[model samples]
Target: MVNILPAKEIYLQGNEHALLLLHSFTSHTRDMKKVAAKLHEEGYTCYAPLYRGHGNAPEQLLQYNVYDWWQDVMNAYQFLLDEGYQKISVIGISIGGIFTLKLAQLEQLEQIIVLSVPVEKEPEQLKQRIMDYAYNYKNIEGKSALQISNEIEPFTNMPLDSFIAFQHFIKDTMLHLNKITIPIAIFYGERDEDVYAQSAETIYQQVQSSKKKLKGFANSKHLMTLGRDQEDIMKEMMEFLRMNNGDLTQ
Candidate 1:
């Protein structure tokens, strides 16, 4: 068994259910604070787990792998269970979305909201660009106001081994997609240059869940939750949770 790693939580007392929010790669729990606040107002407890090696010293990230991150999610889920949360849903952004999907495979989740999940292996050109950016051969650009806050000024340089491990995680997750049985809502940006929009489309088509919805943000980018249409994204999330009776509003 993998060792349980430490995580942070933002709890908003509500009914018996809660929403677990997971942030993207290299991001801190602060990345989901705004969303957590809004969800709190609507009556749901939001627990945002800071993935291992994120929101801290960059070097710490080098010591971890995707399994370590997954272990953190497991620990968070157990925490919620111990707290008497009977029904739980998850909302994850980017790499967090990948972890949410993996969680769905292991647990009987009420609902899942995935934003900008990277389902495909990085394309050659994109991989090269990332490498260049990491090595200081190119500058990292921010496309929206959300990006401005979430973006690392110099862009955190990722270890090559970690990047390769991510590819494995994606591959393993996709192979297990058929095992996910929860209601799923996926959001993708049509203009997203980071993760291919096709990946979201594939997930929408491939998942066997009877209840699933896919929405595209035409003017947004990879960071859909942090981009121009974030409010819309949140609105859709609220509606989905309500429809499933998973919303804390009720």
Candidate 2:
């Protein structure tokens, strides 16, 4: 059961600067926990929302789409603003990073930090991962083999609409990248697929923000938040927020 980890939303209130941390797809809010805790220690309030259809049976994830998660992003941001956190920034990894970029398109965020965001789609890889998640999720839930097959049957054949939604969402976010004018920092791990390296480069080139920085973690892969260089990643994230979050001109 421990092989398929389950997680919950986390909130640690500290100061006026609020950080809305977003997690990756096929994952939970726990992906952002370590960094959120680190930022909270620095007096920055942190909130990591578990998007609808997640943190439950993986079959439930198929019931929702990326648009629903976008609404979750909006709600998470609004929650911070309503809590008097006027200066809110965003940090997202993987699909969460796509949402981060999507938010930056329409919102006046203080800064944006994205990790291992896929500008290009890998359909086969995506399919395998999602199916794996569904299988493991059912397996960990103590479901019988028949029960697992029942829940995973839809995913075993072709791409679901949910998968299509992810593909389209990535393309859609790319179209709006030039609209992001605030400071943005893009990070990718070297051990990840070569596509993510290209993804990092594409995001840096396409974003209209003059204050942009790009770096790669030698010791990290797609899940940079939990990699060997995570501490370095945390320091880099905090420094970016400190440097850009204070600027009122943006």
Candidate 3:
């Protein structure tokens, strides 16, 4: 049986549409709080979902996979639909962004905003180093490098299976990018050491959406939304949402 993660809703007045926000692996909804607050200020009702095994305990991650994450998104989308929200937009960060791209192919979303998505993984040595650090490092607070490394560490100590599953999701999702017709805005950090820079370029080149754009932050790392250029990123997101009928600016 698949366990779909539950979502936490934050309603902001005056927003006619609903926005579904997904965070990166092992992260909670707090990852999108700043972005959600900005969107809320712009009149959007934000629904941030905590993926299965995340924001609770690390051990729970063993039961979750990419499909469970997708299920959580579908459940949240249906909830918004039942709540009378017709226009919907999705914003995902890191692994969440990868799921956003996968969800876009389903044709239910009107617009998508992805930040620092991991469409391509780094080399084997780098991957191993990341896994090792995540497994060994405990005090992550205030350590920017450790925090960034932990984000790509597969969410648990187990390996090979999860890595293969992640790769499958990447390949399968990229193959179906042509099916996504919604307006998409992809943001990346040029200094990101986790995902490949070419991942963004490949997405830009392959996505079938005519209204797609790729934005890169030269100074930021993998956590673009939380980095120094956060304000600029938020501004760009607001502009994109307004242009795409996301109801936040409308």
Candidate 4:
């Protein structure tokens, strides 16, 4: 039986190696729970934080923006630091992956694991996609496009101003990719529907990190963290952590 308490951050105590996990936008920390458990089993401490306006009703998300989400990431990182863990690793899925890359530019991380991150899309392209997604819910009874997007969407009912926040983060991260020197492991599913698989190659080519690797999963999708290859993903992540000399000083 699953525990259905109110949504909250997950903190698992383990060895010296600490992992700060971030989930996708509109998603709660629960999405990272399984991966956190796997890492904890390997003697690694893990923390997964719920971003503002998440883990509750979908309508709550409309009040937040990318900055709020990023602040959540920073807070989680600081919490781990306060816990006296020196060596830290970061992992994120989708938008979470984007935040992890951005965070690496600002902090010293042992390594970063990115799964199914989207490439920066052109302005018109993004606008059209968002609009198309909104159209799907426009006709649903008692469910406006925004409300529906808040809950389940390829595009959320996120306002233009809020949506632009994410675009800004993506643009900023792209500019600073050269600043990320830590080892990075990137995973992309070949059949991913949300993000282009080519994004993995683009990221691999732009990062200044000498120790970076990109791997493709033949049978996974955009939600690779919760997909069919989760076990394989976890195995690969464990190997990556080992190869990067993660401080598992238990």
Each candidate structure's TM-score, on Cα atoms with residue i matched to residue i, is 0.80, 0.90, 0.81, 0.84
- Report the C-alpha lDDT of model 3 over 60-137, residue by residue, as the tens digit: 566776678778878877878888888788999987888888878874887999988766653343236334444433
TM accuracy, model 4: 0.84
lDDT-superior candidate, 2 or 3: 2
- lDDT score of residue 69 within candidate 1: 85
How well is each residue in 1-250 modelled by candidate 1, as lDDT tens digits?
A: 1232334557677767788898876566765777898887788888887777765544455577767888898898898999988899999988788889988998878999998887866534334434333332112232344544344443343435656767888889988988987789989888886455778888888888999999898878877777788899889988998888733544
Model 3, 26: alpha-carbon shift in Å? Answer: 1.7
* Candidate number achieving the greatest lDDT relative to the actual structure: 2
Flag regions of model 4 displaced more than 4 Å: 1-6, 122-158, 246-250
lDDT of 3: 0.74
Residue pair clashes in candidate 2? none
lDDT of 2 by residue, 1-250 (tens): 3454557889998877788999998888878989998998888889999998787777677677778888999999999989888888899999899999999998879899999999967566677877898887777778889878887888887655666767888898898888999999999999998999998999999999989999999999889999899999999998888787664231
**Among all windows of ten consecutive residues in candidate 1, which has the lowest summed lDDT?**
133-142
